[model samples]
Target: TKQLNFLLPDSDATVAFGKRLAPALKQGAVIYLYGDLGAGKTTFSRGVVQGLGHNGNVKSPTYTLVESYQFSEQSVFHFDLYRLADPEELEFMGVRDYFADNNVSLIEWPQRGEGFLPEADLTVSLAYEGEARQLTMTAKNVRGIAILAALKS
Candidate 1:
């Protein structure tokens, strides 16, 4: 797997990076976001949603489990599974439908989804580094390798 590391000095920098990452996404891209509470996962996701042309707020789906945003070209699904009690609940919610070819899935607390979720093309992990944040992105497949390459370039 190919990996990239970034030092985000603040929330703005994290969002900026997410914006930069957005254009590299191919249709049906699945990205897993791994981070602790207050690690800026939602802020980064907001950047991705905005980068994909969503004009409104990109709030976390912590309670809702998933929020869908539609664009002319594709649909983006932002999923926060932090509050989920069982992974099987995803099946009941028609989670597989969210991974359709025309959609991009951004999942937080992906581990909670476990067997219910498809393999992520890319995984992004965020951690605290003093008052700043450190982000590590790993490519898990061909598509992820391409996206990471674009980000590097």
Candidate 2:
């Protein structure tokens, strides 16, 4: 998969990108988010959830690990593996259940859960560059490619 580079001038731009990305999401899609703490992962997720018609407070699953949302049209599971002690804990927590039919999974710190987590359709890496942020999005599969295409148009 090739990487698509995007420049986010500020936190608002990152959030806007997520909002635009939400409508392109499909069932069974997995999105892996890579970034450092305070890099706006939660902010982006909030926009995505809002774009998906979820009008509530969106918080990081730092303690809970995963937050599952059941909407009228789709189900979304947001996972934050920052607090994970081991990838094996995922199985014990029944992480597979979240990947069931018609669900879209958004994962943060996926590297911590490497072997336990499923392959991501899309992988977005965010990094701070000066006063701006750099977002590199890569599509690992056809579904993700379609999402990139949609985002472009």
Candidate 3:
């Protein structure tokens, strides 16, 4: 596993980090976002989606569960499982199908869908640090390692 840690001074810094992160990812990348409410997980994801070529609005799918953006080469799926009462709820939603090739899944509250969700390529944990935010990213597979290494360079 590979890990990278950084401090984001503000929302803009987090967005910048996410924009920089977008290039290192590709299709089938599953990124689990862990953070408390208002910790900027959605803000980071918005940056990633916009950086990946989505021109429309990017908002937390808190009530919708998932929101998808279609791109020429890749599709980005944002999921918020905070409202989920059971992991099995994902199975009924055909969660597996959403992770198909050419798809990038950014899952928030991933713990809520543990058993149904596939292993994440990367895990991003955010914490409040003063008025800023701290990001701790873990690469779980070869693909994730490449991403972290690329970001390092």
Candidate 4:
């Protein structure tokens, strides 16, 4: 329920934050990414995947809407809803299935799929502050708060 704010000096700092967060993640966790266009959502997701032991390229699922990765220990789903015409489209895409007990989901523009997506454990909001970024991590559940604590430590 507490919000933690971190001043990221650059895009690299944001990526580093994501890298620090990835190893602490567990299955069934949901991360909501909120920001305007070109806010480094995809860049952060790349760091997350790399930190999770993934050695492949990470790209935004803008047109496709969702990108899935199957790891040795867990699965990660990246969702970009900017192209979504309606929230109901999530139902047709079986969005609920991605939030099951075995997966961790990172969603961008979550407002597009409000009711269809599961509640986020963590919400990371990125804003451009001059040339740098200000990142605010808000915990919506116990798991998220734990992760934030770990990041702080």
Residues 63-83, model 1: lDDT tens digits: 999999988888899999999
Q: Of the pair 1 and 4, which is ahead by TM-score?
A: 1
Model 4 C-alpha lDDT per residue in residues 93-137, reported as the tens digit of each score: 887777878578999999999889888899989898987878888
- Which residue pairs in candidate 4 collide? none
Candidate 4 regions exceeding 4 Å error are none
Q: Which stretches of candidate 2 lie over 4 Å from their true place?
A: none
- lDDT of model 4 at residue 86? 91
Per-model TM-score on C-alpha atoms: 0.96, 0.94, 0.95, 0.94
The CA lDDT at 62 in model 2 is 93
Best by TM-score: 1
Collision count for each candidate, in order: 0, 0, 0, 0
Q: Assess candidate 3 and give its TM-score to the true structure.
A: 0.95
- For residues 1-153, write the lDDT of model 2, one tens digit per residue: 356899999888888888888888855579999999988788788778877878888888999999988888779989999999999999999988888766888899999999999899899888989768899999998888888888887
> Candidate 3 local accuracy as lDDT?
0.90
TM-score of 2: 0.94
**Could you tell me the lDDT of residue 111 within candidate 4?**
94
The digit string of per-residue lDDT tens for model 3 on 8-97 reads: 999999988988888887645899999999999999999999888787889889999999998888888899999999999999988788
